[model samples]
Target chain A: MTDSPIVLVKPVLPALDKLGAALHEVLRSGVLTNDGSRVHAFEALLSARLGIADLAVCGSGTTAIQLACGALGLSGEVIVPAAAFPAVAQGVRRGSCTPVAVDAERTFLTLDPDAVAAAITPRTEGIVAVQTFGCPADVDALAAIARSAGIPLIFDAATCWGITYRDRPLLAYGDVSTLSLHAMKLTHSVEGGAVMSTVHPIADKVRRLRNFGIGAEGALPAGTNARMSELHAAVGAVVLGEADAEIVRRIQVREWYMDALRHTEWLRPVPFRPGAWPNVAAMAVRLRPDAPVDAPTLCDELKRDGVHARAYFTGRYRPRPIGTAGPTPVADELGKRIVCLPFWGGLTESDVMRVVDAIDRIGGGRCHESHALSLEYPG
Target chain B: MTDSPIVLVKPVLPALDKLGAALHEVLRSGVLTNDGSRVHAFEALLSARLGIADLAVCGSGTTAIQLACGALGLSGEVIVPAAAFPAVAQGVRRGSCTPVAVDAERTFLTLDPDAVAAAITPRTEGIVAVQTFGCPADVDALAAIARSAGIPLIFDAATCWGITYRDRPLLAYGDVSTLSLHAMKLTHSVEGGAVMSTVHPIADKVRRLRNFGIGAEGALPAGTNARMSELHAAVGAVVLGEADAEIVRRIQVREWYMDALRHTEWLRPVPFRPGAWPNVAAMAVRLRPDAPVDAPTLCDELKRDGVHARAYFTGRYRPRPIGTAGPTPVADELGKRIVCLPFWGGLTESDVMRVVDAIDRIGGGRCHESHALSLEYPG
Candidate 1:
């Protein structure tokens, strides 16, 4: 165990000069929130960066999803991936709709198109598909299913800011897409998110929805205050300007983890599709069925080794089935076995090696006995 | 008309040196959001300043209200003043509750306790009382009603940050109180709010609800990401530190308006109750029923004179009664006649005199003929 701790993720700060300049602009303008100039500038910058025509910056990713649902007039039951973050389900409920969980594909851990199609009933109002762990999902297939069912498809691309599918931005896939700029993500606005849509009216509706639904003429609909302040947007503009480079650096970090653990028999990294360009937002590994230590056990071992590993998305993503609905076996198994390793831009190659070595030793059965002995000790 | 525009409200920027120091701390720490250190520190500072033990900073005032309702388990019908901001009704709807509108008292332009008591039915769940334009409401009376009815009282003290009721903080009255730190408020966080509760468990529930309901053990219930970012909190901390002094300055500005307009024949200001300390968040005046011009006409005239006066809270607050409800005549008339004049820290005595002189001329029938001529002109 090393003395210094390795955290699961660290926010990538923007260049000091750029951030200072942005703050200076905000101070000079004297406008802070309520769709101020800085928010407009950030929205313009993000729209250009993501190659989307229209984008609405919001207070958070969850609020972005809720606004998208409201803009699209979604009601009744909405289908979401059971293997995603709890925010996905929470956003669904916040939009005045019910969330019906569906199974995820075993390979990519994204919502399975077949399962979504099967889950759709006459009561289903919309579909929310996630790009799990920055891995690009089968958006085309899911979009086709949604279109056939005459429901809006919302791509929960919270981790897909720097991701691409077939050389185009992954944000181009869904009818309405949401991107999270939380600190934990590959790119951030300190704390913000954006809702993008190809349709101008829907994006306009989202803008109104973020600002109390007050339109140019008058109050259009009922809305809440989900606006990003100039202070946050200033930070966002600076961080987003450097996002592409950070994404490239994170890819190198992901490769370091993959190469270091390729020969290990106990852990398997989630495979990214060949043509998809992933941002590597999180470095997650699943314990093999025959592994010596389970996910929680390995997480505890890593914590003791001065590493902050997480047994990620366990109970939140795999809730007990409602009524006669059967459990999603693949998502449940993935939830039980998956752990997120410490991966951030601040980590050096040596740091990755230390984490890899610790996991390898723990899985080899040598460190487990030492851990048991430490647990038995009085100190 | 002057070349420079006198705006209705301007956000006060914190001291540059302090803001720079705070930004330096955030850059050094690389902690952006998720209730990080700055947010915790700001919450502590505000709780200490407000003399409240429990407070949770959130994304916006509307979200703060929604989180309060969710924390207090408010459901069914919630009573609210129809003269308040539209965000009040929006927040209730977001919390899965129906808002039953009630009229306000003509004297203070706040929720009438008698009206509220008469409006309560067997299905009533809670009461939302607002401090209209920073004038302290009858909190003790409202609290007594809520307690007798066994329902929670949420004080929407969005503009009452520095207000006190009988020398105590206005926040001390309700079961849960929410404050707005929006840019337009007397003191702002750029884009943020806070939820405070007297009950410890309710405050704890609010903390959980603000962060997707993910508690220490697991996800407790469905929640949304309504967290205040560190950047916003940095601004908040600085602004809050100077809030007391700022409130004093705003009160002086309010007095300037009052003294300048004291001799006016066609305008009347809302009076504050004795023994109550008001923050004077806004400088609003109502046109007398026998005045020469209405509120909208006067606002337009002021706008043409390079003063951005607002006919505030029109359609959203004076919404059509849902179902069989009758019109709230008092609130509707107030909404039609009330106008907010230019008020901010930067406004000088001369600026107040200019606005007062313009209003005096406009109401005296001299400026009305000129405006009518201008309207008839093609260019």
Candidate 2:
């Protein structure tokens, strides 16, 4: 087989005809932003599909999380998982709160409710939990802890679009959940995000906060410009309309990788709970403790074969430990071992087999043998 | 005369063929954002046109200012003009700094060098000045004051895209300048902004700051997702290429309104200094102290005539006054009396005339009589 480069993610553009019609409609309306009709329509469509109420679309996922934190008036200390993206910590800091890092569970790689329960204090204002790698967090347990502590729970569900817990939308778990529609996600809007809230008043506050805090009465509050443009909304409306089909395709690709990698002793896939239905936003594998090669070495080997694999979340999320919580040893270990494989809707079964074959060759034995294999597989 | 509803601002969409072609390129490239090629191209094109050294495109004008402030490492109390948009103050606050409101010059309606000078203290970290309504501020004087104080100056040149001071770009006035390309601006992306700096280091920092502060080494700083999408950048590139022509067209529209309203006794246009080339981004009329109607009353009458006139500032920018500076009486008064009229490239000389005629009839006599005059112009 001829070696071909595989990217970790590729955005699936919506059908050209539908996208063109939406763009034309935007041009005709002559309203490019400020919660225009396209934004409203996209919001309505997403809310209906997600079986939620009061979905507010904004510029990007980070901003959605930031706005949700701001609307909830989060301050003092915010508890977050150490193994998440840097944007979660950045959002907490942006919302004028300090981040307290806690470890993720070893098996599922989601925020551990026990760690979160131990991290809370009198100064804790909120909890920002992550649905890591589209694996649903223990939202019920987290929510219970937050309620006992009288703090809000904000799910950094950036990669959890179309994901479900107990056969219901995973977004319905937290007080407010933020969804990312970035290009690398399973579904996207070029660059966009949405804040999903069950509370009407909180959603109303988010609506005002995203638009620079200008309410109907011309009064002001602390807000910034997080408004999503009509053009972006138009793209989102089209992509969201076809998200179900895209999810199905991604699931097939994911299953192919899982089946192919089942015989590999050194690589382990992060397991999800039985009742959870994840969008399969990414295909991440963990190197076993006794693996012959580390994640970085394996990634380098893949690179030599024209395959682009990445060591995911290596020192990008954890900053200096804050709050009274202790070090997150599990997250620290996983951060060095987790590697994200190239998985997307466009990948065929052959592509999956090729990737699996490359990994197998690289992990077969000593460094010199892997080097020879890489040379043989070069394009 | 038939009553025709006029909006305050209308975005001028690029030619259908060109815009469609640009969108197709975005789809083909499959790179939605994260400093894509289109964003780089747009920045280059805009920098060349504006004659600036370093230009960074971002999500919104507010984010541009916030990034500039962050790049400058601004903290403590920063001085700002009271009559400017709320985004200015919000940007300062978002940067973890405090905004000290100061008065504007009565005639120029831009930041007063004297007020800014008086507002400075040992704790003052920077100065944020505005080029109000495309009118040039006393850039040299303000720069001199900042230099003497050893502080950086940031110009909120949001509405001054095509504006020039003494035949030079208005952006050259400050240490860093921000431009808005919102749909309502003279030249726009669907939603975008740019930060221009003569100092390359500051500009580089801003570029990093806008993309979550992830440097090449993977080290993170305090940053959020302020990236402009490729589609928005493509729109910006096309709009910027034809900006000169758009500016020319808008100048004609501005001149027609100015000449038509020259005879009005109760309304006065904000004056621009000689040797300045203003972009005419907005058409604002100040109600003379002896005018028969207040700004709100006039806006109400105009609304009845199917014209949307709006009160300009209306207490949006001011926060609890800080520093040793006195109250901004001039900004306080102007905030109530200044009204922005409908203006855009789509408006014709006839539309200007109709607006002028409605204002004339409304201001000529008793307020109740104006209602009768508005009723005569039906849809």
Candidate 3:
């Protein structure tokens, strides 16, 4: 069934020799994990590359989010953007906090700072802002709201490792910014994540939390083995060496889709915010309301055309967004029609043209079976 | 600081050629994680080797424990063995359940079935039994208690991959048996774990929980990214081939220590259950109260002799065991004076003799400083 010639996000890895060397070093050291020297090396490299002083590498981006929530001592309600991978909300739940989802602004498709402030109640302990598809959230506005509410702000920077705004890294904001180093990300340690923050104490807490809460004195109240293995760190170190090139290639791929779909009436590319650079985790395209075919049709047609595209996060929102706030029209509209096209580095112009050719043959906006519309990503 | 020649558990890895081929295949196919083909192959291989039909490979042993609790629909208080690693209770807490730790039986240092049965209250939801240092728990008795209570039985079988009792793998009992394929264990996937069970549905639930709760149709209520990467699985597959030989070697090392220390009055080997076989995760020695310096001094002395030994789980219970039950004398006795010797596969008879020689020069039991007794596996 998965015979598609091209798929969404074919990871761009380092040269085989670099990865092999890293693996060899891990094998030689016999320190498979437990925040070993290899993990330390990767953390240092990531810190230097991202220009952040405090960071903790963990098992996955979800683990990074989990660590942040755990370190912050958050309880009660955590405000989350409706338009995100459900894992963002799951992170909150895993930390023993309730997730109160709110709508994102139409312009950037990020958490609406106004909605977030309005959603805050005495039960709210923190706010979780997600950079969807590498679209930067309004960090300054969100930070202001957090300060006013006296709640910690956590940015799920899973997709924006290289993203920047006004020449400052988008990750530099928030009490804790969690990054995904999964294979799908521009820079990954095979399967790992990091909890980055300017708040040194929080970063320290995350370290303790990841190591089963064991500190110098003794075991803390709680912690889990959310540590990155040496092998994974080796992969991350090797991958980080080529991250810049990979990010640039990803941008090029995004542009290829954008340029090819510029004149097409059936679909449109999601635009970036001003002075906000993107890492383009997913090159999402919005199917026009007047387009002949709906999202599932476009997804099905693309697959038939030997292209593997996904309608990401469409199920989490649309047909009534799942959250505290009711009637999130902007999120509903965007969520129901969004389709992430085949995107990744090393994609040729010809591949983009093939994807574009398939999209141009859109039909009338007709709904398929209800089950087909329930797209929540490889569930 | 880690310059000791004989440390606790220098991981026995597969040949470089085998590991290299496995990693090369993972690199060849771009699926680095998310239970890909490599993970499937490893799980299949593990199933065949361990003689289990239903299982799920996850991120770590802790994740395996977490998945079991989450899958069993546990919430409320959970019964845990005080003699196990602190992670067992932490896993219960991560599953949003309160850990009601009870003392293990004095014999095998495993959860006493009677104690477990007594600990069960109206609020109790499940039981988490840990196979401390590869010693098999009274599985039949524990299972019977769990069945009587109508609560699920989950064994934190982190150290008993190759261990068997009554001609059956120790993992074959319980509602769900979790394994830690950590580098310190008999067989490892670099840093991996598994949930094994005769209850097929629970195994299926664990698979979903590890995968962000996303299933064939949609998202389940709660889940986490506890996924084993393809690289890790590749490592596991290669490592499993040599696991039997590794187990045999580990058993040999255990025997060597036992033989060398047979007549020593200072410290002696902990006894194993009659029908139970051990994988020998740690060759623990109980320091006689009347013998030479306390566990810390012994540990310090071992280190001084270029043998890096550890006092595992001493801190969590020694001063005062952390759990619902108050003042557990057996746990206190076992937890305070127990020290695990430098034990692992590949330890020669020469190494055993050296360790025994150091123990032979035992002094009167003395507590130099209170700070020195806080030995808990590198904090």
Q: Please, what are the lDDT tens digits per residue for candidate 3 over residues B215-290?
A: 5455654588889999999999888988888888988998888777766665778787788886467888887776
Minimum summed lDDT over a 10-residue window in model 1 chain A is located at A317-326
Flag clash pairs in model 2: none
- Indicate which candidate wins on lDDT: 2
TM accuracy, model 2: 0.93
Model 3 TM-score?
Answer: 0.92
My TM-score estimates for the predictions, one after another, are 0.93, 0.93, 0.92
| Model 1 lDDT, residue A164, Cα | 83
Model 1 bad stretches (over 4 Å)? A216-222, A316-326, A366-379, B316-326, B366-379
Candidate 1 clashing pairs?
none
Q: What is the lDDT of candidate 2?
A: 0.80
* Displacement of the residue A359 alpha carbon in candidate 1, Å: 1.2
- Best prediction by TM-score: 2
What's candidate 2's DockQ score? 0.45
Please give the distance, in angstroms, between residue B67's alpha carbon in candidate 2 and its true position after superposition: 1.0
Better model by TM-score: candidate 1 vs candidate 3 = 1
